[model samples]
Target: MPKRSNYWLGAGLVFGAAFGFALKGIFIKSAYEYGIDTISLLSLRFLFSVPFYIFILSRKRIQEESHPQVPTITWLKLFAVGFVGYYVSAYFNLLGLNYITASLERILLFVYPTFVLILRAILLKKRITHLQWLALGITYLGIVLAFLKNFDAHQQKNIGLGAFWVILSGFTYAFYLISSDGLIAKLGTTRFTSWVIISALFPTLIHCYIENRLDIFNFPIPVYIISMSMAVFSTVLPTFMLSEGIKHVGSGNASIIASIGPIFTIFLATAFLGENIWLEQIIGTVFVLIGVFLISWKGKK
Candidate 1:
């Protein structure tokens, strides 16, 4: 594909991934109404999702006609991603969701773009473009402006702790975005996504076993349905799209593009969770769109 086409395709993929992931908060909140805990919900998500990845992995392996040898170091890197991206970040986000509204949870998590920019600069010595900086400034200005009134209006009692957890979730996930970019480029997004998620599955299962939360089947039927929905729409699909997104746009640009996620989450939260949307938020959404467009259109990937 042409470079311009690649960039637009990647942006669309990231946008799709963001919307899918935005629904995850709604699904989790819905499942929580049935009294499902974080670990159990996570376990069920992986259990339901991993089969799809395993099937993909096996099919890819067969098509290749032989196992390609991966270095021990590469395996180690995938494991690290599994640990931080899947286990710690996911757990923290879900923990925060328990205390905060789904809208707030997504808003807090959107801060990952800042972390992504910082990590790229510090770790990869990647140059931050003028457009990216401008976009970042406008994007966050909108976030603060939109949420300035939100904090006062927010009714969650443990907002501080919840915000802290969600911020940590953003931080860890930013690291994953930075660190996994090369892996995605080298391994191909489909294969890399499958392996990384499979790596994630082990630690998740171990945690479930340790906590005696392995019995995911005991959940109410509605919970099971929601978990399956999240696994397909949120987990499996978005995971690959995000990987492919980074491959084309780079982690920094992809992060900027992903700011749309909170917008999607907020709307979904309003529709499903009855969260209120203020006029300021609508204005902020316009600002965010402007910022995202600056990065997306002003460059050719």
Candidate 2:
């Protein structure tokens, strides 16, 4: 593909991944309504994703074993990242979701890109441009606007706690991104993903046991199906596309493209869940898009 075409394809992949991730809220909420707790739901979701990851790895091993060599230390690093990033962050996110609106959770999660920038600055000794700083400020302003718009007197009861958890999720996700970037470079995207999923299995299995929701095995067929679809569509497919897309687009563009997630989720929520979009959401969405663009779009100097 030409350079422009590659950019478009990467943008499309990122958008699709974000859309799939947004739909994750729908499935998770549905599963929660069916009496699955946060831990249980996440456990099942990761467990189901394992096979898909294995399949991808198996294919890669057959085709390109010589291309990327993943060391034992890399596997260990991925495990730690998966544990903190995927398992812990996702658990907290779902817990927060139980208390707050999905919209709120999404806005909070969108802060991950900012966190990623901060992490890069600290860890990689990278200096951010003035425009990037301005964009970060604007994006944070949009987050505040989103919260203010959605703040309800009745919903304020436990929102503080929920906000804490959601912010923690964002931090963990940022660490995961920072830590795994090198690993992805070494292991290739598919193998790196497989190792992370494999590493996640232990934590998830322990979580399932603690939650004692193995009775998900006995849930209604539709619930089981939806959960599985959540694993495939939300977890596996998107992760693969995003990993590959990032290789093509670079993480900065991938992060900017992912800012569109909330916009897509807002529409999806309105259509299927009968949620109403407030004016604040519209304005917040624009701010997010603008902030992301400002941060990402720069002359090649």
Candidate 3:
């Protein structure tokens, strides 16, 4: 594909991934209503998704008839990255959701873009451009605007702790985006994502085993259905799309594109979860879109 086409493809993939992930919060909230715990829910998600990952890997391997051997170190690095990105980040996020609304969770997660930008600047020695700073400020302001009402109405005692957890979730995920960049370029998004998700599956299983037992089958039918949807739509599909998105857009722009996630999640939550949509969220969504436009506009021109 030409450079322009590649960029647009990446943007589309990221936006699609964001939409999928936005739905995750709703599924999680719904499952929680059935008394399903975080570890169990996560276990079910991976249980449903892991088989597909393995199938993809095996098929790709057979098709290549023995591909070039990856360095052992690189494989190990991929596992480690996946552990942080998927397992740890997801653990914190699911647990955080226990204490916060789905809409708040989405906005908190949206902060990852700023984290990605800052990580690139500090760790990779990338220059922090003035435009990026402006974009970052606008994006964060939108987030604050989006969540302010929830923050006020929140009667949950754990809201502060919940915010802390989701913020950590964003931070760890930023590291994933940063670390996965070179790997995605080298391994291709499909192969890299398949392996990493598989890698993350181990820890999830282990955690569930130690903390929550693998009783996913014991969940109510609604919980099972929601978990399956989370696995396919939110986990498997979005994971690959995000990997490919980073490949095309670079992590910084891809993360910025992800800011749309809050808007998506807010609407989804309002519709299905019976959450109210306030004027503040609308204003916030507008600002977030403007920030995205500011970041993406130059590329199209």
* Overall local distance difference test of candidate 2: 0.78
Tell me the tens digit of each residue's lDDT in model 3 across 211-299: 85666678789998999999999988998888788889986688668767878888899899987778887787677666655654432
Which ten residues in a row are the worst by lDDT in model 3?
A: 292-301
Candidate numbers, best lDDT first, in rank order: 3, 1, 2
Cα lDDT tens digits, model 1, 14-126, are 99999999999999999999998889999899899999999998888889966768889998998899789988899999989898888877766776766777687788797
State in Å the error of residue 75, model 2. 2.0
What C-alpha lDDT values do all the predictions have?
0.83, 0.78, 0.84
How many backbone clashes does every candidate have?
0, 0, 0
TM-score-better candidate, 1 vs 3: 3
CA deviation > 4 Å runs, candidate 2: 1-9, 65-69, 153-157, 213-215, 247-253, 297-301
Q: By lDDT, is 1 or 3 better?
A: 3
Segments in model 3 whose C-alpha atoms lie over 4 Å from true places: 1-15, 155-157, 241-259, 292-301
- The numbered model that scores best in lDDT is 3
RMSD per model, one decimal: 3.4, 2.6, 3.3
User: Which ten contiguous residues of candidate 2 have the minimum total lDDT?
Assistant: 292-301
